[model samples]
Target: MIVNSDLTMGEGVIERHEVETFLTLAEELHFGRTAATLHVSTARVSQTIRKLERRVGVPLFNRTSRHVSLTTVGRQLHHELRPAWDDLRAAVQRAIETGRGLSGALHVAFVSPAAAQLLAGVTQVFHEHAPDCEVRIREAQADQILPRIRSGEIDLGLTTLPLDDPDLTHGPVLVREARMLAVPAGHPFARRASVLTADLTRVPLVRLPGHTDIPPRQAGAPPATTAPTAGTFQEALTLVGTGQGALPAGAHARRYYARPDIAYLPISDAPALEWALVWPADRHTARVRAFVEAADTLIHGHGTTRQPPQ
Candidate 1:
């Protein structure tokens, strides 16, 4: 129970359940929906709301045969209580986690072989730091990273940047590797010492599903056209090998995804590809922070290489 100085007597107190029920009902505006959301019966919801109204000394809602609307007082209360409730819940959760000493499950996902290897290192260090916490790691395709994070299926993602989404938070850059162009072994570009960004105009670039930052072609070159979209990095590399298109890949691919049919040529003028950890902006918990700290400790303190081993 919490005391509300804004209440009628400046001494009104309400149970935690009562606050939850009231807030849920206020948003739903329907007893049935509120009950379903709260996993309680409609009778229980009604009883709770009535008790809250009595305590507040006002009819907080207007109800007729077919409609439910919050009164002026109710609207003001909801406006003020929502943020306060969120803060209270967050505080309690932090308290519980601190008391328990970081001993629960944390789900993390990574895209690409390079990311997987880096995550492996980070996980080892994290386990050493928080041995009681169970770390679950999964591999996801490039396109599946954001959706899984948003849906709460994964607590963190290690993937390519720049992720401009405001809904997600990016961790410190863990790997920065030179950009390379992947082409068929017999392709002209494959035999060159290096390639240029303008060379992208000569052939269709194999497109990754969610990538929008295709290298810009040189001036006076024809505008780039739509290319085949690949769901995974392997598929993109396969497209490159089939002579359908070239792929812009990180230097790490040359080491991890070596293929006889494919050749990786460094892009002389292209900026390095950066890999980082990402998670939902609102879901940054102690476990997530701890894992990020582990990455910092590994890379900055232990002299972890910025690029995958050759």
Candidate 2:
């Protein structure tokens, strides 16, 4: 929570871009690099800094022919203004979240039934944290979750872990469920106590549609004999139940989507499935961060609110 007056100085409230330019250049100490980082021209950075100096009634930088450094006053201004600027930004973000109401639409998607349960609990806790914020939930096919978040169609997603990419920001592990193999109830492997990864992919594996790079081939596991294409999680499960193929899944499936025809056998050598909250890198905001924190608390902290990562 912050007050705008704390950021305002005298009658002439300084422009934001100027502050940004000053602070960025202060840290970068290179006009070209600062401009590049800010997506502005070097000339623009110079103009903005000069303007800021005039407004502050002092030289902010000691510029030589080959180099640049923050003047003593500039250093002081950077130290003092940085925190105020952060407060101002936080206040504005809070105001935006508040103006939109904790009731504003916060679209979220989930790909698995276990993730759905965790998200339901997260949604409840998030609502309690910010009653006016509304959480809109949707079912997402495995292949569609990341795309929807990247395309700005959804604010957040509950999906599998290890989605390491530059464009995505994934939160901490919400749940770690043991891995299981979904096979036709009558399959020979279904009768076994457990299946090893070395033998898990001997049969065809139903894959999430649109995901072209299937994993066993990459992970050094037994190569799947077939890669059946399916558009939805249920479709993939149904394919496995009917003997079309097998699918690796979280153990939660045995409870939420148990079927007489579908046998979920433990994968003795498989790693646990880690589900986390994920959102696009650029769209991170107060709401997204707050909701993620709430989720981390409820799911990882066992109902007690936990401090989010710095």
Candidate 3:
């Protein structure tokens, strides 16, 4: 017969190690082997088992010099405690997820044109879905975003993909765009329906800094004249409109700028860019899920009207 005790009636210290030791001994059915597995001496294992039995006020094992077996009460306790321990583990996991600032500040990282256009929509949806969350956005290049994710500097990243890193997790948010040449109204290519990579060879290209990862380089064109400094798509568009040189920007760049002075012409045979949402592989939090869902809704609603880089 077993008597019920109320664990909540008084403060009692139930050390986790005692439970672990009990489970280990139960599995091994031998103190020496169990101690070996636990990296402790056999005497230490015996002491821990004795302590656990005494705490519960019940003998847990029937033992003699030749063999050891569980008492009837011990077998009953094992059945009850094992599942209780499993439930406790699950409860602890849930608590960690809930307590890790699920409703707190979410730091997001993004790039330019998408940052200006889609970010607001994503944030709006996220706020509507998770009203308790506070969001912040940071802008950085495609290459710089992942390192921050690994270091825990940012919660999520919106950028171009094919990261190829095992430590990062990526989800396709929206097909990104290709690098379209933004030219003034009077520029030669502006009169044509579309421009080819070879056409920019002679033009004064207001190219992004040399490190900018635009695709299908102008055939036989000179190397990029300067390093890329314009971090935002808007900055690049502004420079193209006012400067004498032509600049390469994403398809959405034209819409983002909404400038009549400039026109965006596609570059035939250029690589298409992919816009993706990236985060640390280990960061499976509620806030992250909420943010990704909101982003997906916004991009899916936009559809394939914006050509993503292939």
By lDDT, who's the top model here? 1
lDDT of 1: 0.82
Q: What's the TM-score of every candidate structure?
A: 0.68, 0.64, 0.58
Q: Give residue 306's error in model 1 in angstroms.
A: 2.0
In model 1, the clashing pairs are none
lDDT per residue, candidate 2, 1-310, as tens digits?
Answer: 3233423555566776777888899999999999998899999999998877877788999999899998999999999999978877887886776544455779999876666777788888898878877788998877788889999899999887787679998888776667778889999998988887776558888877644223233354545676677887778888988889988777777887789998888886666666678998877777888899888778667653332211
Q: Give the better candidate number (2 or 3) by lDDT.
A: 2
**What is the C-alpha local distance difference test score of each model?**
0.82, 0.78, 0.71
Model 3 Cα displacement at 237 (Å)?
Answer: 3.9
lDDT sort, best first:
1, 2, 3
Q: Clashing residue pairs, candidate 3?
A: 176-308, 206-246, 209-227, 209-228, 272-309, 272-310, 273-309
Q: What is the C-alpha RMSD of each candidate to the true structure, in Å?
A: 12.4, 14.0, 11.3
- Error at 147, model 1, angstroms: 1.2
Relative to the true structure, candidate 2 reaches a TM of 0.64
**CA lDDT, candidate 1, residue 295:** 90
Give residue 131's lDDT in candidate 2 (0 to 100): 88
Q: What is the lDDT of residue 305 in candidate 1?
A: 47
